[model samples]
Target: MADLLDRRQRLAAALCLAAIDLPANAVAAGRQLMQAASVCPGVTMDEIPTNSRREALTKARDILNELISEASAP
Candidate 1:
């Protein structure tokens, strides 16, 4: 969906903001980014119901925000 893709893009941009300074936990941050990027279902999983997909995206966004905050911390 366009909305999900847009949110994904926004989240990716936010994640890149952390890379600007290259945080001490760069590897962890990279991992989190990968997790955040995996909004779609995996090979083992069946197609996600529409509502479940929306919920997953929301959870990913929340995780992205936490990563951004941690990256911004002094």
Candidate 2:
């Protein structure tokens, strides 16, 4: 339970970092998230924001959306 929560946090942090255009230790963070997720198979990527700070989560979402939008632009 606690481990699963930790992984969710790690994923949120990693995505937040990526969204902000910052270089992140994503491989390690992803490993933690994956391990935690494996233990709790029902987990979804959406859980990341649900388990983090509201302000941070909002920023992460906005940044991620922008990043995706930018990437998809031709």
TM-score of 2: 0.34
Residue 67, model 2: lDDT of 59
**Model 1: runs farther than 4 Å from truth?**
1-51
Give one digit per residue, the lDDT tens place, for model 2 in 1-74: 35534444444455444232223366765665666455545656654442444544585566566656876999
On the 0 to 100 scale, the lDDT of residue 72 in model 1 is 100
Which residue pairs does candidate 1 place in steric collision? Answer: none
The alpha-carbon deviation from the true structure for residue 12 of candidate 1, after best TM-score superposition, in angstroms, is 10
Q: Could you tell me which 10 consecutive residues in candidate 2 have the lowest summed lDDT?
A: 15-24
